[model samples]
Target: MKYRKFGKLDWQASALGFGAMRLQIIDGNHGNVDEIAVIKMMRYAIDHGVNYIDSAHGYHRGNSEIVIGKALQDGYRSKVKVATKLPCHVVNSTADFDRCLEEQMERLQTKQIDFYLLHHLNRLVWPKMVKLGIFKWADKAIADGRIAHFGFSFHDHYDLFKEIVDSYDNWTVAQIQYNFMDEEFQAGTRGLQYAYEKDLAVVIMEPLRGGRLTVPPENVAKIWEEAKIQRTPQEWGLRWVWNHPEVSVVLSGMSKMEQVVENVAFAAHSQPHNLTAEDLALIARVRDTYRAMGPIDCTGCRYCMPCPNGVEIPRIFGWYNEAVIHNSPQRLRSYYSDPNMLDKSERVENCIKCEICVEKCPQNLPIPELLDKAHAFLTAKG
Candidate 1:
């Protein structure tokens, strides 16, 4: 495995980080992880030189850390740097920080977290975290040796990302969702470069856009085939992210043994600026093809945000676009309907035809009309 410089730290992190969010599960149950399989897959990746294992308090309904803890046993724990997140959403008080960290350490069966993150920092949670004294608690944790490094995973705009980075000078890492399709999405390319410039290790999540890029549409597939040096969609997506010298690691949540093997093989030869001009042109065509498949022209710029009726216009459009573009309507429909994925209050059903979003939209999209279509399609019964 290739190792890269981790921000300003002396340590080198593996190019491919093993994300434990999507470990094998039994009977399609999120909480019922196939422990034996997960352990084996994680161990395989570790054995193959993937030295970073990333997990979270809420991944796989909290069973991910347990399985990772099991996998790190038998002397494997010494071979890797374990990274996990504190569940920021559930912390209601200053004391809750220590409570959550203690619980997470217990679950991981580790006394020290090599890299600890404030999980899923967003608009609503950022202020609350500051008000509750997250930085003070983090300093205490680091000084005590419980946390080796401090970082955060983001899901907000680039401006907010910049503010957060500027707010903390001791930040060691910044994790963001990035891919060819999401260059303008949450914490996109601009944020990636900004964090790197600030000497923060940029760890990438959703490098394959949650596997949506792996299974390309017919037009997208054709674009890949057009390349003289052919590669899988997975390879293209991962290599695209790894091509950036600023990225320290690209995390993939492998659920199968083959995926572990394939990703490890890919990481072996991965390098920044590896792709040629032709390769890049082909990938751009593929990206354009996928974007063209979406019915909504929304760019996720958040210009039409703060809907008067609490409607998440961009998020709703994103779900609808993903459904149509990936040809996964049934799966996305279920996801759209899940209250955990998108709160019922924020769903498109709350749109009151205020035309406020329409006026704010740079795309000039018929905001209410599109919301009605999105509501009908997303809520449709199988």
Candidate 2:
């Protein structure tokens, strides 16, 4: 397995960290975990040199942590560093912090969480976390031996990411939803480099864009097929993120044994800044091709945000484009249906067709018409 310097932590972490968010389940039931399969695949990864296991309090509805506790048994716990998150969205008080940490510890069956991150941090939650004395709680956790290192998994604007990075000098690591498609999204490339410059280890999540990049449209795949060097779509996504030295380790939620094997093989060959000029050109072409396939030219610049009626116009369009361009209707449907994923206010059902967003949009994408199409496309049953 290939390894990278994980910031100032002085540890040689595998280039590919195991993400436990998408464990395979039985009959589509989130609670009915396929434990035997999960255990075998995870142990296979560990045996093959994946030393970092990332989980969260809410992943797989908290069963992920429970399974990790089971999978890391039989002396396997000593082989890897377990990372989990504090579900900051559920924090109603300062007591919730310790309560959740203790609960996660019990779930993981570990005394000290190697890496504990503040989950789903954004511009809205940072101040509340600070106001609730999160830094003090972290210091206490570290001093008490419950948390080995402090960090946050970000999902906010790049400026907010920099603000959070600058807020705490004790932050040892940070996780972001980064991939080939998200270079300019939340905490994009700029944020990745900023964190690295500050000496914080950048752990990448969604290196495959939640598996979106793995299955591209034929238009995009043809670009790869025409390239001199052949690689899996997954490899293209993984390598794009790993190519940057600013990144520390990438977290892929491997759900199958084959994926684990393939990813491990890719990690073996991934090196910082090693993708040649041709390789970069190929990726850029593929990205542009995929973008061209989308109906709207919305760059996700969020310029048309704050929809007067509280409609998340850009996000709605984003999901809409995914369903049409990538042919991922089922995933988008599930994603949109989950209230936890997006509020009802953000839904297209909330769009009042005020024509205000259309006027503000730089793409001039006929915002109302597109929202109608987005609503129709995403809501259609398969």
Candidate 3:
């Protein structure tokens, strides 16, 4: 496996980090993890030199970490470095942070977390972290040897990302959702470069846009075929991010053994700036095809934010767009039903036709009308 420097740390991380979000499952059921299959996939990845395994407290409703703990048994624990996130959204105080971290450590069956992150940071949670002195807690954890390094995974605008990165000099890394289709959304290339300039390792999530780029539409597939160089959809997607020197690792949540093998092979051979001009042009075409079919034009600029009714406009639009773009209505419905979706205490039905977001929208999108559509669709499905 190819190794890259993880920020300023002496240790080198594998280019291909195994994202445990999509570990082998039984009949596509998120709750029913195929333990034996997952173990096999993990062992295969380890044998092939994948040393970084990432999981989270909220993934698959906390079952992901348990399955990973089971897979790391029988001397497999020492073969890799485990990275997991603390659910910062659940933190009401410093005590809650302690409780969550302890539970995560127990769930993973590991004494020390090689890389610990504050999970899913946004505008709403950042202020609370500052108010509760979260950095102080992280500093203490690092000094106590409970967490080897401190960082966060982000899901907000570029401005907020920079603020968070600059908030602490000790932040070793930052994880963000990035892919060819989302180069301008949620920190994109700008945030990655900013973090890199500050010497923070940038780990990438959703390298395939939550599997959208991997399963391209017919038009997208045709564009890939015309690229002249032979590559699978997965290889193309991963190679796009690997082409960037700023990206430290591309995490793929592989659910099948074949996927694991293919990703490892691609990572082993990928190099920065390896793609030619023609290759890039082809990718641009594919992106255009997907964008044409996407539901919402929301750039996630967050201009229409701070809703008076406390609605998470960008996130709601995100879920709605995913449903339309991927044609996975059921998946979108599941996201709406998630307990965490109600955290702000505002649902699609709570819009009340305030029209506050529409005026602020840079895209001039019909915010109220869209919310009405989303509410009807999700409620009907529920």
Candidate 4:
């Protein structure tokens, strides 16, 4: 387990963080965690050197934190920095902040949170959080020693991400979705650098893009095979994230014992900017080849912005492309159903066949038809 500097905090966090979102489970259901297996996996990872464990109020329907609470017993609690998040979507009042935190602490069997975050930030919830006095409550929590650090996990575009980071100077750390293939997507490479420039510890989520990158497409696998320097798909994915000195810890939702073993070894040998030029070119080629498999070729130019009914055409297409390209049914379904974006009156179901966006689209995509396909595929399993 390799440790790295975690922003301005006077601590060195392990380079690899254990994300409890996908812990071992008895059933396929979100909450049916296999407690015994989860305990062993977490303790074994910590015993090796993973000093950071990240969980969320909604991960595994709250079983994630509970299992971690159980694993941290017997003197394991002091060996790691426990990170979790506030469920921002349910915040209807200022008091909900304290209520949720208390619930989370109780679930975790802890008195204080080492690293606490605003669960998922986006355009819709950011202003709502501000109006609800999140900062005032967070200030009280920090001053009272109930929580040690403040931060957020983001799912919005780079512009909104910059705004949120600049809005709070007290943020000690943040988490973002970064991978070898998602350099231009939400909170991608640009957002990572912006947070780093602000002196914030940037933790990486979905370093494998929800496990999609771990098994590259046939073309991508062939490219990897010919890279001359032999490596597995998982190693390539992780090393790319660690290659950047800006990244503090790369989080992986390890469900099996073997994953923990392999990822730990990779992190131990990871170094920033260590990939050779040939290696970088190979990675770029692989990313491009995989992206070409998408059905919609939307360039994300935002020309079709402000969907007449607020459908968010570009974002919808992006998610659709992601679902098709990665075959991540569960991951994309969860993202499509985000309360911040979906479940509103403005989702794909509300496209209404209005060709207003068709006229504005620079890519000449059939906006209404594409939305229909996206809706059918994403909502099919759910």
What is the alpha-carbon lDDT of model 4 when measured against the actual structure? 0.88
Q: Estimate the TM-score of every prediction.
A: 0.93, 0.90, 0.89, 0.93
Q: Write out the backbone clash pairs for model 4.
A: none
Spell out the clash pairs found in candidate 1: none
User: Which lDDT values do the candidates have, in the order given?
Assistant: 0.89, 0.88, 0.85, 0.88
- Give a tens-digit lDDT track for model 3, residues 1-382: 8888788788878889999888777877887889898889998999998999999898888888998899899999999988999887788988988888888889899899889999988876788889999989999999998899988999877989999998998999899999888898889899999998898989999998778677777877778888787898888889999898888888899988999988989988767898999989888888777777867787778888788887778777777777777777887787677654445366776677788899999899999898777767765643
lDDT of 1 by residue, 1-382 (tens): 9999999999899999999998889999999999999888988898988889889999988899999988999999999998899888788886888888888899999999999999988766788899988888889899999999999999877888999999987799999999988898888999999999999999999899888788877777888888897889999999999999999999998989999999999998778999889888888888888888899999998888888888878878888998889878888898677654566788887888989889999989998999899989998887
lDDT string for model 4 (1-382, tens) is 7788899988998999999998887757778999998899999899999999999999999999999999999999999999999999888886788888998899998999999999889888888999988888899999998899999999878889999999977999889999987888888889999999899999999999878888777878899999888999999999999999999999999999899888988888877887899989999898888889888888676788777788877788888888888887667778788777665765887778879999999878998998898888878874
Kindly list the per-residue Cα lDDT of model 2 for residues 1-382, writing each as its tens digit. Answer: 9888998888988999999998989899987779899999899999999999999999989999999999999999999999999998789786898899999999999999999999988755777899999998899899999999999998766878999999988999999989877898889999999999999999999999888888877788788998788898999899999999989899999988899999999999889987889999999998888878787788988888778988777667777776777777898887677665567767887878888887788878798888888788888898
| C-alpha lDDT of candidate 3 relative to the true structure | 0.85
Off by over 4 Å in 3: 27-29, 302-315, 334-367
Q: Please report the candidate that would top lDDT against the real structure.
A: 1
lDDT measured at residue 320 in model 3 versus the true structure, 0 to 100: 77
After superposition, candidate 2 runs with Cα above 4 Å error: 305-311, 333-360, 376-382
